[model samples]
Target: MSKLVGSLQGYIWRGYLMAGKNTNKLLSGQATISSKSYAYSAKEIYYSTLPYAATYHKSAVTGYDPTKTKPETSYGAISRSVISNYQPSMTKAQIQTVIAFEQAKKSVPDFRIVDVPYQASDGTEMVPVVQVFSAPYRDLDDYDHDGKWTTEATVRNVLLAQENGSGKIFESNPEAQQVELVGPQYAFPDDDAAMLSSNYYGIDNTTRIIKRVGQFVMLSSRLKSGIFYAKASDLITLNTNKPTVIDGIPYVTSMPLAPASPNHYVDTASGKALKAAGYTKVRTLFDDSMNEYRLKNGVWTDSLFASFETKIFSPDFDYRHVYFNVSDTDEGKIKSNKVITLNEGNNDFKKLLMAPTETLLGK
Candidate 1:
């Protein structure tokens, strides 16, 4: 079998060439079905946003008037407008350049240093290393230098274009690269990120990174919060250091939702940490907005219909925010923004599945 090109994310997967696999995973949580064959994952996780341009409405009177019949609501096509939200991922060359600059951080002021890990030949892990970096710099003094850096590239041009050898700025790097840049974090399982992978954020569940079979590339997503894809050549290399992914495909299952121990949000890493210990299913709250999702076999699922729970402040702690929790009864609330509480009563909130009981094919 050959890798199927992902329609949404554009990467090729080993299993079915499903178009919405990643999106479905993002929209729901987990692949629609399991695969026994090899699946390709990625180093740079990507989230695709297809602009949804549809007809919108302008609200008008809805009540019926005694003198005249109620007027029908008018609908019109939404005018296409420029959505400036496009921040393309950094290129490998750009990543390398930035890493190189950060490698020599003393030159830059007020820079944030990031820590990353490298592995040893003996399968032992090397202590995480730190690198400090600042934003890109440009020198307007020579606007057209034709260098890789846009600011540097045009330095000479600016000088040539000037008359009487007049130039305004001495250095541009301080301004060009002044933008806040976050160094890459150690790729660890994250639950909040997993929830964001699906709709709304619509980062798509294909957010996690899984490398395709035998490629320098590791699948990842820009939607996965502060993480974006760059070619392997662009990534900084350390001895025994390369990006890692869960399966061949960086789908939702890779997020670490699994059998958990009670209150062991303890040392348990993200995704792997579940509220109810050893639970196969549990209700999870998402964001301030009441979005709910499910988890199973390490994969997150979109089960919008969830039981609502009522919560009160912790008796022992200085509680401020109100918490909505799942009752011991499963029939109540199916979704929440956080793990409020669980009850094992006839409602067994833990067993709630996003898919309706009858909607599920085989128990």
Candidate 2:
């Protein structure tokens, strides 16, 4: 979610650029694979353009590994495996652009290297960047458990240059000092995929309710049956003026749909229809915090929203139900659509919390 500052020099510049390039390659590869694989049949190609088409044409496009005794086969499984195995291969245009950029980089003087300072929302420089204990890639003595072969300095420098959380400072000069860094953030790919698939037939995954009560940060004490995620800062002030001393977090919350699956293909038909109807499908998650709704047959419907989690493969089709958002408009759709619920029984809740597995962040 962080933007690369292209004008900066040193390791941060290279890391950001490489990370951006890798991300671009991964996305392009996913699109290409999805396009080619879905062309297996006319029906599949047509269905790929439909809303939640993954559910409709998964079986037809699926192939098996004959060598395996059980041959676990599903279009989602096979296509995702293929996508994960792809290597970065830049197009001619991309190569040309990279060449031009590298040429430009060589022209910049060492003295002109830019170092933007990061600051918190309260205009404080005491910001924390997650940096695992690892040495540089060249050293090879240490490795990031997250699988992003970046060093601690590379992670810190790149994160600081980006304008995430709080914005970066541009005008004034600030003193450079060491800040306490946190440990690594683990990746749970199977959990992520299971949640997104919403068809956890043989998989077991759970969500934890994290809360901060005063100075102690711990799991919620009373909510035994549900899960919730909240930042400590957000829970600092309790409005006592309200009838209740504590307010409950929503069981389900919605974000702008960001398809994390490598097998997730663009539903151009649905996208075009929505655009013609004055609605645009957004790629950024959490941009809209309200539930979205559509008007159908003179009635407001949430069928489209529910379709994301409801329409899956057979067998689980009847019982595989996750909390879904039902809305009729884009207004506050993220807030209204609560597909990701707090119940531990709902494994699909992990879909919102985990990142896609193929990328650097996920690794």
Candidate 3:
């Protein structure tokens, strides 16, 4: 069972959804309203499906028409009517770009202007990992020679300036350029309840101190990582030669992980445990109380707060970006102990967190 990126949220889940592996089996066998009978107003589906703005239709001109009877209701019917949204599953190369940017900015503070939900060329308006600079926030000041916190610019300029991929991919193919430009931006919500803040800066809704530097470039991919990111100078080193042939194929030079720190995070104990289980490039996230480990050999290996509330770094194994996941919460609260196994480069594998804890079991 090969793993593939999940179509809905863009996280790497187990098995290939296209191949129809564990999808149905993973389901609760629930049914939705649209799955049942007549067509509901697109408006209803819009609000119910996306949570935000209301989607309305033009009112009928004059008189009323049909007097049809309303149908039965259930959690199954209404909720299931959800329109599954596909998000950007960036390649290993793309993921590294975000990581490099974040790594570059180690001192800059976090900043937010506005949230503008957008639709990609793919017709999906998934959460952007980064937003705000899409249109220049003319009011904000533009500063340079600092860490990742970029100065304000119009939204459009931000998008263009923040593009990824070698120009080669775009030089010959305009269609491909459109696709890359519109990929998902991983948006990290400052406040789930407060929604959006116009002038709110440096403070969480409940007044908790929110870390300005986002470890992972998620929710929206359009917002490029700032200079304060980890990659700073060590991310990708430029090579000078174009090899005539490798295994028969000519080699082209490009940026690759520069192998910055010798400090690979791993618990010799956890390392021994997982290695005994056949894991490679496996490392741990730890502190005073918890010790969590994730395998880097897989396609998508993020330290998801949906599992643990702590932070972790996720880079593509083919050695692309280094997306860090740094959380402000306590280590014990994180869904620490788990195993993510894979079969191929950065986009294929299984995420299995068998024991959801960070402590050692006496057994």
Best by TM-score: 1
CA lDDT, every model vs. true structure: 0.24, 0.24, 0.22
Q: How close is candidate 2 to the true structure, as a TM-score?
A: 0.18
- Candidate 2 local distance difference test against the native: 0.24
What's the count of clashing pairs in each model shown? Answer: 64, 18, 61
Q: What is the TM-score of each predicted model, taking all chains together?
A: 0.19, 0.18, 0.16
> What tens-digit string does per-residue lDDT give for candidate 1 at 1-363?
111123334554323223433422322232322122111123111111111112112212221111122211110000011000111122323223333443343653322111112222112221111112122334677542221100111111111222112222212332221111111111222111111111112123334334322312223343433222222322221111111221221112122333355422222243444423343343332222222334534454433433323232235321111222322221223433334332211221213322333322223
Off by over 4 Å in 3: 1-110, 121-244, 247-363
| Worst 10-residue lDDT window, candidate 3 | 191-200
lDDT of 2 by residue, 1-363 (tens): 122234434322221222322222212243422331111111111111112121222322111111111212111212233323221232223222322332344442111011112221112121111212121132366542221111121122222222122222211221321111011111111222122233222100222223233432222112221111222222222121111111222111222223435533233344344445544322211211122333344323332232234345556442223433333333223323334423423443323322221221222
